[model samples]
Target: MAGSTPNDQPTTTPEIPDHVLRVHRRLVEAGHRSLLAGGAVRDHLLGLPPKDFDLATSAIPEVVDALFEKTVLVGAQFGVVRIIEPEGEVEVATFRADIGIADGRRPETVRFTDEKEDALRRDFTINGMFWDIDAEQVVDHVGGRKDLQLKIIRAIGEPRERFQEDRLRMMRAIRFSTILQFPIEPETWDAVVAEAKFIDDVSGERIRDELERIIMSPHRLAGYHLLSDSGLMQCILPEIEQMRDVMQPPQFHPEGDVFVHTGLVLSHLSEPSFTLAMGALLHDVGKPGTFEDAEDRIRFHGHDELGATISEQICDRLRLSRQQTERIVYLVRRHLVFMNLPQMRIARRYRVFEEDGFEELLELCRVDCLGSHADMSLYETCLGMWNEWKERAPSRDPLIQGRDLIQMGMTPGPEIGSMLEALEDARRESEVVDRDAAIAWVQARLDGRQ
Candidate 1:
């Protein structure tokens, strides 16, 4: 049933290029009925480039194996096979209807069925539609094409029953809303809010992966809003929700409460690396713990250090890699270093800049300050001073190495290590240049200490 228009102008159906269409044609020519399915069709209709193409066919796993030169019957019992081709590989699954998902995951038994039966069991309405490559018409038994046009995300059947089969779909609804920038239909949203607690049945790794995508979305704020409204935030990330009413001082954080401040920072974020984003989110988590009100003003004493500890535990629980955990924790702990900038000398400034990934730390600082004050003067001042230092006295290797100190009548011990570090600091500060000047500076320090 190809689409028709008056005057035979050939209503242009978006063409699937020869390469991909040929793959489907090969399967059909082998006497197997096939249709392009899932995200590829959804993306095509949305005018977005699809990441991968998937297919559903009436061909049994054995027939699929014989037709393609390369195929893997990894889940043959469930009617799925991986078809390999020179250009790309696509997943071709025989139409399946699932049964008995009592554990909130995995179908107890999968029965081979017609395409219509398979479509009925899918999670969302829009993702249930399929495209007929030969007829050039979409097969929409679930009114999915209409839902897509309406920009609605609705469950396929009784929302509660669909969600009961896989609890993770609750979060997936939030993710789709964020990714597609579409509204979750009222009934669907209410069902999600009611069943949000079932998300605990899902694995932490799966939950973390979905949460990361939500945070990275362009509409992160909206996603978070949905997460809270649907009660998913309380189950997944209660620490964030705790910031809601916790107030900060009026002088520095005139923006509002801790949650408001955090949201503002998130909104300003522009595709930062994952570690940076996580760090930014958790940077002030310890503020609530360290909050104190007294005579002069409010204070979150040592919150930077405290937040680092909290971040470590959270990252570990979430199973982050050691290096990733360390980087995020470092950012959280050292975020307040810029506040001490006025007291630090040029040498101290050089030391701070010399730390690993110092530029990213500076950017984190920018986000921190702006979220509270919307004032970047301090950040800009530091950047300007750093640039000035680089221009006037570019960094270089110290003229005096540890070996030089050892040769200069200094024993090879802790004293020599200390002298070598002091010499490097002097060089960074332009206080000393050559070996002679370094020796003189070290001697002055040692003699003064004595």
Candidate 2:
């Protein structure tokens, strides 16, 4: 999930791959003016390699289908078709103008139109340019080239109308600003702020995906600040807004407030995976719910566990994949284990090293500390111990297995799992020295329970 740095400066546009150029030529040769459209044109001008290329043409979907050997009419209503080749595929869509509906993204009506009309209907000026295939120049009907040159994110036409046609455009605006590291135009920013609440009209999956892009970017912390400033954070993640101004005991957290501390944690991360980023953001999420001022210090009695539950609910709301949610929750729940780890028994420490997500957990621990007290003693210790056992112990054959337990007269059930955990813990401590000893120890425990 860590992000890579993009190109330093805009360069000459990338040469069109032969297969892609073929589609453009075919459309043009047939007298249907085709030009490279949307992000590809924008990225080319920016010197970033566009992931995929799309074409906008005067031809309709049916004409495109008839022209190409391998074609799929992905959206006949919108006049879009995919041209497949041995190398890859290109999406060729008819030039069209659209009207945004109030409730959802589907345009009220789509009319096949010309290049100028299509460019005017787009979301952002930077993305509204088209590459003139024959003329070797950019066709900027909506001042896209100027906006891109100035490094500003500006809506194509009326800002409100552009966002209202599709609410997801609001999130996309934030995403582009954050990723491109460009400031939003004043009017566009206001429109996003005024219509931030409509983000909910977009589906959870769509929101999740766009949010993922923002969270995954290196400038994500800035993205969050923008989200908060623009009021989008409240509609999308009110839980984060809850952390605003929550006080921490100054002795431990010299950082100003909960939100500031979380931002610091986010800043400390470099190329963080999605799980790490989420864990950092939600690490102290439960502080508000569990905060208590006792005689001695401010306490969050069970904030770690509580934060885990709350994070799960948040993840479910965002429609995160089950695996991503589980790992994130694990990091939040066990983040405090490091403070107690120094006092823990050797076996317990080793067990921590052996946990499934130990590496990510350790990272969470390091950042959590860096964000707060700036302590590294515990992290250094854990890293040392883990390094010592790095070659052995963690992967050492379990002194026993389920089948071995069954052979010793233990049935296949939940208790077998329990026994294995206990046996492994004892084995790590050398309390059970070998396979025979492990079997004997478990047999005795089973006998005692019986």
Candidate 3:
């Protein structure tokens, strides 16, 4: 009777997954109360397809294991289990109340409890409601429905206490506000500012994950502003914070300071990849330190090179993969090279496009232009060249190899590599189009050295 769907129908019926419905039915038939909970319920109510289904119930861990055919004790000690089915995996957590949070991340202990106690222990109100599959209603014990209606993100209870329980909640609050396009309740936002520094207590990996989600979200610029406004940026990414107030030449960057320029560039990204997003965010990171009030105009001499070094350090701190670090660093280093495109010879342009992640580099340049002066002249030229190049036959295979140099009576050493590089350059420029021509060119250079 406790799990039975109410006879009356609700205005909006959640498109519950068939597998989830089966599991819910099974648990109910077994006399254990079960309800769909957490983000699934929130998303459903908002008319978005739920990401995943999580079940909360009165049944304890052991009883849940007995009722389900395939059960994984993912967090058994904490009253959580994973029920795997052909359709999908549903995380089933027992109703429990958190006791104490000693580490600022997890509760030191938890006690099994009823629905109200469980709902009260959650971080945000909108994430605290449950959908009663049996009752055809949303069971809101913490005013979650009211908050949802107002499009506000409010902590479940005392804001400070909730944040103190998990310092990462500060970032989560910002993320939810950005993603949902909802404003944080004033008190909750104030708590975020007050507890911003404590966010350092969270692990770098967790913080990085949260930041990545914010970067990938459609409202990334909003998230960026919230992070800055909340003071979390200073604690987690002071490099970015330092960009604040750093002036760029107005002629080149009509977008105010480096920080404003960076935000505008980020906003213009179309289908951002993580590396490209990070590169755009930190492209001019060195401007603050390199800022110079020159006689002619503002100058950030060598900012690109300095920014690359700084970006690598930041990547290391965030524990990004070696590959990701290298690509991001490449972007930062080469972002300025596009200005030299017109001066470069055809071979030089080919070499530039041959480098790894050249497409992303071009994309960063386009956004950088759009964000600043709205000039696309250079971007259009480069794109035209790239398109024309793509239509041509692929660059022919190198006409010579290191082994060829050795066979040509050259010593197997650094000079061999040097010769090969010179030959390739010639080949790229079409000066040497055949194997015999490549050999003849190399011989001529050697004879000249003599």
Candidate 1 global lDDT: 0.81
Q: Residue 195 lDDT in model 1?
A: 93
Instruction: Order candidates by lDDT, high to low.
Output: 3, 2, 1
TM-score, structure 1 vs. true: 0.88
lDDT of 3 by residue, 1-450 (tens): 111234422367688889899888988999988989999878876767888788999999999999988989998878999999998898899999988987998898889999999999999998999999988898889987777778899999999999999999899998999899999999999999999999989998888888888887889999999999999999999999999998888998988999999999999998899999999999999899899999999999999999999999999988899999999999999999989887799888888888889999999999999999998999999988887777775565777788878887889889998888777777777788888998899988878852
Clashes of each: 0, 1, 3
lDDT of 2 by residue, 200-255 (tens): 89888888888889988989888989989999999988989999988999988998
The better candidate by lDDT, 1 or 2, is 2
Tens-place lDDT digits, model 1, residues 143-248: 7777777888999998988899888888889999998989999999999989998888988777878878888887787887888889998887777788787788
Worst 10 residues of 3 by lDDT: 1-10
TM-score per prediction, in order, is: 0.88, 0.91, 0.92
Q: Relative to the unseen true structure, what is the C-alpha lDDT of residue 222 in candidate 1, on a scale of 0 to 100? A: 83
Model 3: clashing residue pairs? 5-134, 5-135, 6-135
Which residue pairs show collisions in model 1? none
Can you tell me which runs of candidate 1 are displaced by over 4 Å?
1-22, 72-74, 86-88, 389-410, 432-450
Q: Which prediction has more favorable lDDT, 2 or 3? A: 3
**Cα-based lDDT at residue 199, candidate 3:** 94
